[model samples]
Target: MKIPRVVVGMSGGVDSSVSAFLLKKRGFDVIGLHMVNWDAQEEGTSQCPRSKDESDAKSVCDRLKIPFYTVNFVKQYWNDVFLRFLENYKMGRTTVPDIDCNRSIKFDIFHKIAQEKFGADFIATGHYATTSFGDFQQNRNDSQEIRLYSCADPLKDQTFFLCTVSQEQLKRAIFPLGSLQKTEVKRIAEKEGFHAVATKPESMGICFVGKRKRFAEFLDEYIEPKPGKIVLSNGKTVGNHKGVHHFTIGKRINGQYLEERSHLGYFVSRIDAENGDVVACEGSHHPDLYATRFRIQSPDWIPIRNPLEELPDSEILCRIQRTHPPVPCTVEKCETSRFLSVIPRIPLRATAPGQMCVFYTTKNECLGGGEIVEIQDTLV
Candidate 1:
């Protein structure tokens, strides 16, 4: 019997390091593939640089006695993920680039290379999401569908980011850290003598963007800042902002012009990109912050062969943001086949445009997700 060759995405972090270690220990032909998605040299960042990650990844592979290769996906990430991210931000929508990066670069681009070039039967990552194959009666051939489930660690579950991954990609993907908690992973890494990365801090913020720079500073490098007026819901101009792209829905507005009302800490309700105006509302529970209905575009359903035909009038749980809990919702098909209307059982706050709305079964199986294109506040 031929040994199954598994290509693991090693980020030099504790999770990926332990993933590679576990796969190799399971008697599989494991190879480490480190993706270089960002060039830290260009940004001149000393904190959490890609070079350090690459070095750590290489070191882990050496310690594990496995072959390691670095693949540069900087151009691909910039073209596929970063470009779309900027476009969404320009439209004044709250975009999650991590979702796009997982869909386009890691599972799509890297998966292809791992299979065709590296002769890999499976590509594994340290993502905290589980994949299971289950029979689907909805299929004409009674085929099995790949279902994504929440990781054992609820606090660290990343099914939200993995929601955009397709069935085809999930079939070839493996997540070794799905059943383990962060503390357990650290213990295992330490026990296995991978001490350097066992205690390494997890990377935060955007993936490609180093920790040394602020998110707005990174965006300013690509997008020219357009000064805009910040107005209250009553249409009173209270302050000026650097750009509409700098603000997200529900984020508190802090500017020099609004010093008198600074104690109140007004929240952003809308971004008029065309006129360069950011609309603000008073409290966290402000009417403008809640949305009763929203429209999702290009929803990727997991098991259903035809989502439009199967999902109309269907009820499912919906998660509007990454960390937000799943809320009961009804899906109403729109006139256009490309869009679906989602009405939450209760009003949801900050249903920002461009953010993903992930659907799930009652049993916690991730059905898939779509980009939120429109929002309707019943109070408004």
Candidate 2:
């Protein structure tokens, strides 16, 4: 029996630690990877998050007695993901840097390093999603396709985030933690005797800038936060929001930015960067930000042979964001099932630009997903 080489992305967290341990147990060769995406100064810490994360990964690798490697991707991240993140927001469109990170860094760049440089057969992560063969794969389509499925633990499922992974990446990806619950993952890490297992807490918020008090402070380092006024759709100045950088479309409930009582718990309808104003309306009575008709372009999920059946008798259900619930929707139009306009059966909430719109079959097979380019009636 020969060992299949695999590279495990270890972030010094419990999930990735267990993933590495499990793959090794299954008789696969495991190499550990830590990506350095930001400078220590940017994180305002003695060391950057990725550096610390890599150290944790090194500890896991040491315990497992596997080779550990680190790659500096701060420049790449700045050009590929972070710049796009800032540019999109300046344009008043919300962007998901995580999606870009998957496209450019994790799958594209990292996959190349794993295969070409490390001579690895596969790259594994702690993501809670299962990689399986789809109908296209069974039938042997022109380009073999891969299916991404939700994890057993619905509460901790990260399938939505990984839906953008291409077929090639999917074929070479392993998610050992998909079948295990988060608690079980911790247990496995402990049983394996990995020290970082119990020490590190989960990392969250914009990768480098977590617990930094305010996003304004973070952006101030790069893009100066322009002072903005909070107003109604009619341009009635009710109050002043901190800055244009601090708001997104459809910020309801707290409405903390709108320091005025006239709003009745307002929702952010639109943002004007030129005028530096965020338009608001009553949250309850506001028109749902969820679009009845939305377009998805250049989808990564279309199988080469099947061609996505442009005019299907069936409709597609989509979740525009990871946290947002999926809603029943109809595909108004499809181009090789690539570009599609989805009309939801009911009103949805807070649809923003630069976010991922992930579609799925009722059986839980991920169909495909794309970025939100533009939104309608998003006036400021």
Candidate 3:
């Protein structure tokens, strides 16, 4: 009998290492595909060196006795994910590149390559999210639909990063680390003699940019800094800032210019890109820092169907950031079907524009999400 072929995205990390091991152990014809999304040669930095990761991935594949291939997606990533990320920053919105990377590169492009080119039945990743299949719906031509669920490790659940993935993409995707805890994954790697990556530190911040340089410094290379005035909510000019694009909503401002107000702990309330000014509030709990209602754009509902009509009658939970706890909110359909009005039960701090607002069922099923287009100020 021929074993089904599976392609696993090896990121030179512990999770992916264990995923490849588990898939091979299950008697599947497993292959490792390492993606070179960022060109570290251009950046000329030892930080996040693509060559290092490629070497590590190759080492892991060799140890597991599996075939490994390196695929460069730098051009695709630049056009699809990186360009949009820069545009969002230039427009003064907090952007989530990880979400875009997963949707465009990992699932869409990589999944296509795995099936069409590599003759693989499934494409797997180290994502901490699980997939479930339901009965075939007769209405949709008797086709099964994929549903996304939170991982067993609540603290490491990554469903939020995958909210934009379509049903077709989910159908061919696999997440081997979904049910395993982070600690257990490490143990599996060590027990299997893949000790090189067993204790590797997890990557953080932007995957492409790494932590070698400060975020502000990295942005300066791409976006010219436009110095602007920092103002209070009441229109009091407090000081000057390097640029409106340098700050995110709800982030605290700390510099010599804010030295006097520093003791008050001022956080960014808003960014006026047109006027080139940043509005700040006195404290984290300031009324100006919170919003009870906000609007989202281009929401991609899971199961590939609209749940708008049902939202008005039921409360759905919304998460503003990946690590944030989901907050109960009511969805109000807007005049435009593409846009949605979300009213939280309580005011939320730093409902940053350009960030995603993921909706979920009470049972932790990801319903979908959209970009925060507008924020309603209930305090006024």
My TM-score estimates for the predictions, one after another, are 0.93, 0.88, 0.94
Candidate 1, residues 1-380, lDDT tens digits: the string is 99889999998899999999988888889999999887665565535477788899999999999999999998998899889999888879999989989999999989999999899988999988886742111111226666788888888889999887887888888888888899999999999998889878888778756764567777777788889888987788888878888889988876553634755678888888999999988887788888899999968877647543555434468998767889988887789988988889888898889999998777777888998988865456
Off by over 4 Å in 3: 134-142, 259-262, 310-315, 378-380
* lDDT measured at residue 34 in model 1 versus the true structure, 0 to 100: 97
Clash pairs detected, candidate 2: none
Pairs of colliding residues, candidate 3: none
Q: Each candidate: RMSD to true structure?
A: 3.2, 3.7, 2.9
Which number leads on TM-score? 3
Model 3: per-residue Cα lDDT at residue 139: 23
Higher-TM-score candidate among 2 and 3? 3
Q: What is the C-alpha lDDT of each candidate?
A: 0.83, 0.72, 0.83
Can you write out model 3's per-residue Cα lDDT over 197-228, one digit (the tens) per residue?
88777888898777556777777777887888
The runs of at least 3 residues in candidate 1 whose Cα sits more than 4 Å from the true structure, single-residue gaps closed, are: 134-143, 257-262, 304-315
- Candidate 2 at 188: error in angstroms? 0.7
Model 2 over residues 1-380: C-alpha lDDT tens digits? 76679888877888888888888887788899887777676777323366567777898899899899988888998899899888887767777788788889988898898899899877888888875642112222335456677878877878787776777788878888777888888777777887566657777667767667766677767776667788886778877765676777777624455556754577777677788888777764566554656666656673333324632435456888777667777654555645666566655567776677887766666767777655543222
Candidate 1 weakest ten by summed lDDT = 133-142
